[model samples]
Target: MRKFNVFIVLFTLFSLFISEKAKGFEQAGIYSAKIETNQQQQRIYGTVTDQNGETLPFVTVLVKGTNIGTTTDENGIYEINVPGNVTLIFSYMGFKDYEISTDGKTKLDVVLLESTVRLGEVVVTGYNTVERKHLASSIESVDMERVVSRPIIKLQEAFAGTVPGVTMLQGSTLPGDVPASISIRGISTLQNAEPLVIIDGMEQPLTDVDPNQVKSINILKDAAAASMYGSRGANGVIIIETHRGTTGQFKVNVNSWFALQNPLNLPKFVNSADFMRLRNEAYSIQGQPLLYTDADIQSAQEGKTPNTDWVKEIIERPATSYNTTASISGGGGVGTFNLMLGYIEENGLNKIEGSDKFSARFNTNINIADRFILLADFYAHRLKVDRLRRNNDGHGLYQIAWRMNPTQGIYYENTDIPNHYMLHNDMNPVAFINEGGTWNYMYDK
Candidate 1:
């Protein structure tokens, strides 16, 4: 029995030794054998630790010379059998690459630096690269990395508070008509001060271009900077560069976001009493009958009929807005082509009224004959505003509530109120509201 027990123990020890040897054999393959025979054998073992000293899993370990590679396990430990004189390469995206040599060491730890190309690198100017050394021209280049870092749906939203000297006023909330007024470097011309926008080498209206596809936006301010654009540059010039394809296999990218757009600011109007007083003054000065009796005037004074804040009443509502884009880009040594499709849906700030906007853009670019290149882009947009009314006309919401008679019933035949005559064709404020007219205004002719 003692001899049998001793034999069993020996067998168990032999099995374990064989198992370990098998494992070693599996790790050291044909490549390991070649290196061993050449007297250039190396057994490199290392642990990849992050900045927090925690083991990094699946870290790639490569020997620079012979294509011998291995990956670290969950415990952040890796082993590579290579020739002793070869260098090992370690790399991970967003981290600097590390290279080391094997002289006899068996353990190593590497920490990587975070890559920030935009912050430290030079920015592209016109044709050359310029270190932002203040060329002095009121030029404000919106930080693309900062703005793009946040998952923003619209490109215009990127201009929120970054563009110095530029003002963005929220207009309507309608998807396409999200009433926004973009004024660059202030209003220089009374006639039409809005700047001319050139997107991807194509001159187009700002409203026609959706912000979802913009990669970067650079604003050229100051007369000297904009002079190159001629008359259209009087207001200023905004250059929008869209995203393009990168070199590699074909790739697909989808960018989508859902957001709620509500009124950021609503102009305050006079209270019923204050509103009534202003109207009565205009009536008396115009030699018109007292439109409101004490009671009728009181109703308006106490927030009754004829005194309702129509602008607030009609325009205060929440709306859902969103943008989505799908893009594919990739190519070979010749060049690359990037394609993108995008869409947006939104409601206006007006509670019950709104607008719908649909837009499509296509950009195609290629190297014509090596040194010379050509790019073609087209943008088309359609807008439809429901509950369309002249809210900004002289006799529109404001003047009607401010200068019209307060006591007079909203509508009465043979009314005794005076109408605006300073402008010959100026219609009565009441008629302008209940009845509608049109003004001849066209620019694209």
Candidate 2:
């Protein structure tokens, strides 16, 4: 392999016609410069490399608008004589051409950027895999590295901008607002438009799986690809493969991240002063009794009196959340074993609304006999989520919070209940979250 590579490099360098032999001249900046050239011509030579500094053999170097050119050697070095100042053009297959002015100097190393088209690359498709040149179906691979680089709590959140044909709608920032649906081909039918998600050959909800455990994800979007799954593939198909044990020495991996959660856009509401003044003016115009007296209005406007903000009270801002996952994997001549443990704490927009999850997974492959291996895997997780209560009529806590009167206090000064202040209204958001009610959901799977 090394000899083959050396041969290719040498062939590429020799393919280009190098300049006159070096004689009694210093090197070009860093490389040996060819000298003893014509009085009217100058020596220009440099190495051509790719973005990563790998020497690119077979690169074409030419003086713009002329046939005078040379190909880069196996070492990517090209020595040429230029007649006065001119633009030097560097061209290579599979890379963008680079141009630079001689600018009256030597040592002009060039770097070329690789073209976006990646040919001959292998890709996974529906029920099969093929190279890019042979692939007839539309498939997208998710960048799991970029996805898990951050502290993402949900699977859909990691995929928002990672792949094409996936759409994420504006949903609540609350911890319980888990993604349940996705659209790839748009609304083609009236039934479930959610794409079919297959994890390790088992059909399941993508949102239920954790991003840390996922190894690779492939999406099948074209009609030809969807045909394999029948109607279920009409929406789309997502194939996921989880991380497994590796052979050789034992390895331990741990990942932990912290993130501050905040709403992208919070609703803007009128202040208590403006709200009170507007209400009083309306009452006066209707010939009804004024809600606030001159002194009361002055005090409220001057910020002397308390002006409650239900929205702020209902939603926690800049909530902090974190997650940690640890795994151990190894393999021997007889078997391989992998075990993982994870914990996550996710805070929601509303105080007292959050989620805690604990998960464990163990997988092993035992070679009971040659050519006959047994695979056993076990996974368990416990999840507990807390959120504000909702009524049968769908009047959720946030809706009630938005409609609360600005003047209505969260709680009365005195209350009949011992050691507890009574709420000014049955719909008080703070009271509901503090005492009225809340919903706690626990799941073990």
Candidate 3:
């Protein structure tokens, strides 16, 4: 009986202890719920703009002392959920960081100021890279964004009307021909005035470069700017730098454009009747017999004569061209890579003349031992050009076409050789173009 009494007393004490613990837990739960109810989450919205009142996209907006963050959209708008009395941070490239306190308010708009110091901008010269402000010589730099904006057949064509004191004179419309005679600061020398072109420290023709892979192009106009090249800097210097991968996430870019070309401001040619009258007048003035008889002139006036528009026959209408480029770039802990592929097809005003180019480039930078960096660049391209067969005298078909008589027909009624058209004065422009066969020149680099 004594043992039973002791057991009952212990049981009663244990029950009382359990009840006190349950009450404490209930009070703690109520306190936590009240705290959570007081800390209400409010939606914050704002726009980020630059000092010039321009919307700044891709700006990073973050809540202070927390992992919550968001980026501004293309329209510079952002929304976030955060507690009161918290601060928001805004940051972007080339701009000063901005911070605003919520202070129990929901909406906050910010205008970031531009960084005053621009010494970080670097320009690549042939020998080395220097800060743009520190460079003492006259150098003009063009970035890839500007270079690839236009539909250009050759790299040299990108300089048209863009570079100061530079003139690009296109002498021929033939495909794959050297684009234009590039003159910097007018004629710098009496002979051989072509500027020296350097691509990644190697002398190369601008035509061989793929504009899609270019990172930047710098032109050294003054002797001091190009003195490193010695005698090659007499005329001027063009330094081209290809793109290299950066240390970040992977990126892909695709660019394409289609264009049509037609002859601009072409002179109007005389009709058959007018041509005959002019020929007769020229013959009479030169004390020679009339080339066309009265019957022929009458027949031409009556639209019975076969008068072909030679220019129209030789020149193709609405020549079409297209260019496409795709590039992939990425970087990791120790290495980075960039690969680009490009294709271009340009048809000339002449049916038989056209050019196609295929190009590939790979650039890589490997960090060795966290100290040394190894950079490798590989580029290759194949260019195929189709042109007319030139005469033995080395005159191009277009040149001969200009000298041919407008009154002649493209073909003859009878010929000894099968599938061969008649020749006029040892040359027939149309027949030569149609029957001379195809001439293709291919170059790989």
Candidate 4:
């Protein structure tokens, strides 16, 4: 590989030598004296020596613009004949490039330091690159490897495990949905809990982005970095950069996962006997008539005869989730192209129903020339949801299940009331489920 690289470099340099001899010199300068001074051109004499006081070998001395150049002799000395005002460049592969004005001086003695590209400082501000020491603001960077390390379903999920001031609050009331609360530097508003999300140079809502498509996520914290973005950045700005291939190689990567989730914080509801006791206490305080007979009262005093576990009945054991993603990317001299497809299946604790999603994405970057670049991207997702129940908030499920009398069975078996509508105002979980009062089918794209 080293030999191949050397060959390519030498071949290109030789081609430049044979194609033309540099000759763009013109009489374009200030006065007649300056023109007269360039009659025979001038000579810049320089000696190259290593740091240990030993003469260095084979240093190339060239004029800045024109490709007219020569190498030092074995003694590490060279004299280049050029215009007195021209710029002389001293360069060695491992040493820093030195440019000097060939005016008002003779015997130029140049000291060069070892060039360290990898250890040298690099700064990334937005999409621009500058020296690390030049930045005055506090900007954080997340590399590609670190972004993909987590088992994240949404692009925002990667931030959950990484950022310090950022907090993620998963919604307990709604399970299969994405995280509802994401705050940076604490919650700034009761109306809006999420920060601003930006992809490339365009702005987007974080909830609309998928993790599989992202290459990195950068969180710009503090006022110094956030102020430039104006009002939209009061919450903070999450910048996302997607992956693209180089000009010659094809890159393919696949990511997939299967997850099982039980409820993180499941609420415990009182059993039928305790519930009835509380209910009787409330009725007594309100001066209402006794709703239960002596036999029902006897059953309620015992811990268990037929107590309903309302929370358990509504929430199933665990839900299963699976996500798959595949992408193909390649490029040549003309341009680069990328295509990706993703599918997700999520099931909630409600055993009868779940949510499914499928998405497709397209991205392409073209090098218009050596100095210009063009990028284009578009993506869309289709979602379908099958839910056995709609949350009428905490009121529907809890109000019904907690108040159902322990004496009554799920069906009206051997009840003296005889009519299903007898307790129309009373909370009944079985009736809510049977009467099709809690079901939903949603399609969003």
Candidate 5:
């Protein structure tokens, strides 16, 4: 009876101890699970700025060692949820990368500095990218942003007064004409002093290219810098780099402009009465009869119907021009793409002369197995120009007007030919300009 009682007491004590220990373990596990759930997630907020105290938009903020990331908004603010112990990375192009530990904090503000290493400032040469400081030659670079901000029709027009050692002699203000005669370093040779122009490793006229598509323009002003082209580089060299796609999220840009132009520094001409009187005096000195009758001179002085001001009749005022461009660019791990489209319409001071242009460009880069890169660039443009015939010569319509007798009628009542005007030298400026005097040029490339 004593042994049985002792065994029961011992067993009951063991049971109670085991039950209490198991309950303790269960409470500990529940507490551990609660702590883990709380630490698994955290809401973070931050702002990013540059060294200049300017807020940086579109900056990439990423969680380190994870696929979770978000971009800063236009206001340079970001919000993300991440693990408490993880690190946050802030990155931007042309700027240094920055990192910070969460350290149980929920807000982080960062400022990134521009990269300082001069070796990374690359200028595209003919064959490769050479750093600006390392090049052992004279070179000048023009920022594309400044060039494109100006409202101009031709790409070459942007070079005027912007580039050093480049003289742009603009011959005429006519639409669709070559913008200027470019002379590099002041007339190196007597014949063909124009520089050799290279656009994206191809030789083509810069006038055909859209200013919006240009990324950079570099001028190699010395033999040392331009010797890569051998004999062709004697005049100098202009290397143009076009914009390309970058690996990032998709983006689109659109730009449009409208401009009005007026004719500048036009010659002042004498009235009909003064011109005729001067002519008669010269003719009289040479022992010749007077060209104008007494009635004609009286009519001219009184502002009669025969007196003509040819300059006012020919030129139009407030010439209008417009251009619009749009581009889309994006990329991924596999490849990148850039597409652009543009349209331009320009009217000259002379109503009969005008031009219109349409352009499209596609540029793509594809990575082949992380070893080879396939690059494809395609550009096409259509240009149409309507101009006046014989206006390109010295003895054109303007010259004809100087010698025309204003007393003559624009149209004769007894003329057999259709639309024939009665005039001196048998050449009427109005008749020539209005009748079959327009030339149309269409170009496709």
Candidate 6:
């Protein structure tokens, strides 16, 4: 019985040794090798460790520029089949990649250093700023410098196509009547899906802020958003940081630009002569009486009658728009402060439509005794929009012009009367905009 027990003990010990050796062979890519293939391929074996000589398990050992690779075992032991004149790369998660050449020798051990890239960059999150690598998968940040340089009249228009997982709603051209709105990636919620917006740590509408003054915009989605503001950030969170003074002498900057606004495309209607001919042809095909006489058609074709272009009469070409912004920023022992003044004037396609806006922003940080700091912000803006009447929203204004008959001119032959009447089916679109029957809207906030 004693001899049999000793035999069992020896058998178990030998079985463990074979299992460990097989695992090492599998990790080295030698388990799949054939006896004849071993004669042509060279086997390179190595151990990957950290700078402190700690073994790094599961490290990848790959032949450079080839899809051949293998992973190290738990003991950091890796063996790969190579062509002798090949380079090998060693990589591990969160560590710098280590590379070496197999210049005829077999053994090639390397130590990998930890990567510093994740430790350097920072990201703004819900409660505080975190390192970029920690939350990069759930957060998106905008490149403000690139976006601010665009020629945008409304600050809301600046975010047209900058970030991913965010959608900006279509804006209006009715001067100050348009406000910017954006929706983040759709969240599974019964409530509204609009993302929560916080500008300078304060709840405010996005349209009220100027694009030039923004320094950074951080969007938090998924778990990163829900853990911050609870249900308020259920859909998503957009945090906006405005430009503040830096530690430097007083610096002044002025930016100005102008753009020619024109309608993208407008419907072209047939002239009066073509309209009469087409109408007569249609009625004749339908076996109905023609509306115009032969003399009228003859006179129209001979250029004796005028072709009224109602669109040109009401719409202005190359509507001029200009924007200017000036800002002063500085800092001292007391604290930092930034003051900016901006103005924008825009002419719409319609003759009676135009807008001018003035805005000023001042933000400061004052250091108190030793343990306190005061942050104060002031923003004011005034807007004036012409012909944006309370009753007429301008949504159907252009449609009326397009549907108007081309037979009537802008004014009557008798110009002695003030507000000379232009009639088209007793409804003239040009008169609604040009006849002093419109209202202007002025807003200050």
Best by lDDT: 5
TM-score of candidate 1 to 2 decimals = 0.50
Superior candidate under lDDT, 3 versus 5: 5
With candidate 2 superimposed using the best TM-score fit, by how many Å does residue 190's alpha carbon deviate from the native?
A: 6.0
Model 2 weakest lDDT span, ten residues long:
17-26
What are the candidates' C-alpha RMSDs?
A: 16.9, 18.2, 19.9, 14.5, 20.7, 24.1
Tens digits of per-residue lDDT, candidate 6, 1-445, equal: 2433443455456445644653464445443443435546788897888989999998867665533677899999998777546778777768987778898888888889999867336777756788886664578888777777777776567667888887778756666666456778754454776788888777777767767778888888776787878888888888888888753235666676778867777777898888898889999999999988888878877877767777677675567777766676755434667877777777776666777777788899886762477999998988888873422565666666777777667777757887787776766766767664667778899
CA deviation > 4 Å runs, candidate 4: 1-124, 130-133, 142-150, 172-178, 189-193, 265-270, 273-294, 297-305, 387-389, 392-408, 414-426, 430-445
- Comparing 1 with 3 on lDDT, the higher-scoring candidate is 3
lDDT of 4 by residue, 1-445 (tens): 2433443455456435422321122222223435666455567777887676566677767665543466677888888667557677677766787788777777787766677654335544455665657777665665556666555566656665567787877554333355556787888873465677777667876655567777666677678445767666777777777766543345565677778777556556676666666777888889997655556667766743566665566565587776777676755434667767677776666654566666667788776743476889887776766643534342456456655555445545466764453233565565554454544555454
TM-score of each: 0.50, 0.66, 0.71, 0.62, 0.74, 0.68
By TM-score, the candidates rank as: 5, 3, 6, 2, 4, 1
Lowest-lDDT window of 10 residues in candidate 6?
1-10
lDDT of 6 at 309: 76
lDDT of 6: 0.72
Global CA lDDT computed for model 5: 0.75
* Between candidates 1 and 5, the lDDT winner: 5
Query: Which regions of candidate 2 are displaced past 4 Å?
Result: 1-120, 283-290, 302-305, 333-335, 349-351, 365-376, 390-395, 414-425
Clashes of each: 8, 5, 0, 0, 0, 0
Taking the tens digit of each residue's C-alpha lDDT, what string does model 2 give over 299-328?
878877667788788765667777777676
Cα shift from native, residue 445, model 4 (Å): 5.7
Model 5 per-residue lDDT tens digits across residues 1-445 = 2433443455456445644654465456445644876766678998999988899999987765443567899999999877566788787888887888888788889999887755337887777888777888888887677878889778878778888888899876677778688878898773478888998778888876888888888888888544698878878788997878765455566677889997678777777788788888999999999987777777789988466666666564677887777676755445667777777888876668788888888888887865687888898999999888857542477777766665656777676888767656767777767773788999999
TM-score of predicted structure 6: 0.68
Task: Give the Cα RMSD of candidate 1.
Answer: 16.9
